[model samples]
Target: MIVMNDSQYHQLVDDAFERIEQTMDSDDFDIECDINGGVLTLEFENRSKMVINKQEPLHQLWLATKFGGYHFEWHEAEQQWICNRSGNEFWSLLVESITKQSGEELSF
Candidate 1:
């Protein structure tokens, strides 16, 4: 596991959130994104929601979807957030979860 200082971890996670927000902004999906208190919430048209938040103490990112919850840790070598349990990449799993919930395909 790679060890990141507090500032570095925050910056990396914040950047990921910003990227997600930007992607949502440019897409035509009916998902609404709101970030507050370092938590990103995505509300879909069907009233389902997905949440992504940073786990500062663990230096990990957490995501909750209609299906289940996932914990992701930053993989410094791959430069991606990878689920600790499933070993799925964060963005890919996120897009998959969104598609499953919203019935629309999205890439981020």
Candidate 2:
């Protein structure tokens, strides 16, 4: 696990959210992206929702999808968020979840 201060973690997450939003904006998918109170929410055409939020105390990112909930911690070496239990990378999981819910393939 990488040790990151709260400011660093928040900066990383905010940058991530910006990248995600930009990607989504460039795509023509029926997905709505919204960020409020530091939480990112994606609402699909089928009415399914995925939430990505920061866990400040734990220094982890939490994602809630229709499939399940996953927690990811930053891995400095890989420069990616990785699930501690499943060992899945955050971008891969996010793409999979969005495809599953929206039936549209998206790259993030």
Compared with the true structure, what per-residue lDDT tens digits does model 2 show for residues 1-108? 789899999998998889889988898988899999779999988888999998989989899998899999999999999998899999999999899888989897
**Predicted structure 1, TM vs. truth:** 0.97
How accurate locally is residue 97 in candidate 1, as Cα lDDT from 0 to 100?
A: 94
TM-score per candidate, chains pooled: 0.97, 0.96
Q: How far is candidate 1 from the true structure (C-alpha RMSD, Å)?
A: 0.7
Over 1-108, each residue of candidate 1 has an lDDT whose tens digit, in order, gives 599999999999999999989988998988899999889999999999899999999999999998999999999999999999999999999989999999878897
List the global CA lDDT of all models.
Answer: 0.93, 0.91
Q: Highest lDDT: give the candidate number.
A: 1
Candidate 2 matches the true fold with a TM-score of 0.96
> Which stretches in model 1 have alpha-carbon errors above 4 Å?
none
